[model samples]
Target chain A: MSILKKLPSKARLEQVKKLSSEIFGSTWNPNNIRNGSKILRAPLKGPELVNYYGVNDSMPTFQDFKKWFPELKLVDPREAYRVKMVEDRKKRNKGAPKKKKE
Target chain B: MPFRFPVKFDIPKHAYVNARVLRDQFKRIQYADNEVTRNALRYLARNTELPAKVRLEAQLQLTSMPKYTSYSQIKNRCVATGHARSVISDFKLNRTAFRERARAGLIPGVTKASW
Candidate 1:
């Protein structure tokens, strides 16, 4: 007979496994079933993926400048021309209908 | 131009917009918005320890979400021209645009190879 004692019982092995798993902060999955932990382990790609389009850094138009700094009293020449054309059209009675005063 | 509706910031006038680009933008937005919930449900559905009914319910919910919410649907498109094919992700420009810009000295550090 060997000097060493017999192998530990199945229940005792199970207890040891459970305790070790608990101590090590690991999942006690003796059945080796699917836990879907892989999915959680993968980093979330949402924030980076959404920002892939990048920020809009287009040159600010005159209208935008006015919106940002109203005190500057900036006037866009194109807008002035458009308003003048609209006035001309209104004088000729070709403008859009006025909204009803409720 | 990729967005049909107004966003927080103004979209540049030169940004190309088309039906495909519009759809891709929608998918990207949806994916970003629902990614967390989708992953959670996926985890639940795949977990064998969970009750069968709960797992089934999670799967059903996952299926009910829009197909656009999936990341695989997003296709990289040219930011300048909205072309779907041969897009170089580094500059987000298609081959033609990339070649034109590179030759015009628009893209930095890219010179014509004529040795």
Candidate 2:
């Protein structure tokens, strides 16, 4: 299954869609298929399953928009921070000692 | 995110940042939650005629993971105010906060409805 090979014709596309429908029934999310040289997209499916079973063993993924666009830098603040939970507790409860001194 | 008590802060910036961190923490552990149940179910569903004792053990393991880890535990709250109950998806704010902001023209292209 050389999935990298482009099937650029209506006859080739129906063949792939038929094959994929047989393989993955419910979980087969499809793709937006395009027509050649016209700014047009035909409603279609089986691209995801084609990529999944044909190219990749696992599921296909959404394209990484952050890599494509410089402005959208995704960051999880948890990576950039430490809360010091024990210190926060001590400061919050300074009047009443958290632990008894021996 | 719902595991942590809604953080109340005098400053909106502190509250929003704290909530964001908690939400990210929730995302981190979510895989573990799904993995525990998924593996257990797979053992039951895919395996053929496993010993009753082993199946029971798998069920027990699935039940043992914290209730907090369940998908139901994650909640959307207003990032600005930490209001939990009625947060709307579009602006991520509870109705009260959304109304205030929309009325004040803080949220672009949204206007309060009058009947």
Candidate 3:
């Protein structure tokens, strides 16, 4: 889209939360999404003691979910990351002491 | 999307349908321009007896079309969020949205890696 957001915002978050609920509502509980992973033990007397599973369940990384929000106007991370890196480098070097001459 | 000038239409990306329409329209323009250019060149190539004046005129006509009609000028944006950059044409989503939706199981079979 023409208008691209460089950073995440509350509006984007709210939008995706609504979407996650809409898409996953039939299958998952919203409360369980952000609860992180859990271990489920095999039923009855099965030899499989425990099955380690569920990383954020159906929920993706907080920032990663913004991709699905049609109105957020997100930009490519490649360009955003590059711009961030350059800005960071400039900031990091701004206060450095001058090198001594030989 | 932006206004695709010389085509007398705006690329309306505020909404998904409009964006899609714009992209499709530009693609059609691109194809038509290419066909026109190709046919003109073919006529020039096959007509050895054609006068130099007509041949030069055909070449000029081919170059006269706006570059905006070319497909390369068009970019795919995520239909959901209207996000730019790294839009996967197959998925019609930006990288972030694709990963999220795929993880959410909106897209079949593909899942996100937790590690």
Measured by TM-score, the strongest candidate is 1
| Per-chain TM-score (chain B), model 2 | 0.56
lDDT of 1: 0.82
For model 2, how does the per-residue alpha-carbon lDDT over B3-114 read when each residue is reduced to its tens digit?
A: 3533321222223445453553344245333544544453563333566676667667656765544545556566566666788877777799888898899999997677
Candidate 2 or 3, higher DockQ?
2
Which candidate achieves the best lDDT against the true structure? Answer: 1
C-alpha RMSD by candidate, in order? 7.5, 17.1, 29.2
lDDT of 2 by residue, A1-102 (tens): 887777589978877887887787532224532212121122222222112112222332223443556577755355434345555666778443546567
The list of candidate 2 runs beyond 4 A from truth reads A1-102, B1-55
Model 1 alpha-carbon drift over 4 Å, by segment: A1-33, A57-63, A69-102, B1-14
Cα RMSD of predicted structure 3: 29.2
TM value for model 1: 0.62
Instruction: Between candidates 2 and 3, name the one with more favorable lDDT.
Output: 3
| Candidate 1 residue-wise lDDT, B1-115, digit = tens | 2546433333334457776766777677778888989999999999988999999999999999878789889999998888989999989999999999999999999999998
**Model 3, which residues run further than 4 Å from truth?**
A1-102, B1-55
Better of 2 and 3 by TM-score: 2
Ranking by TM-score: 1, 2, 3
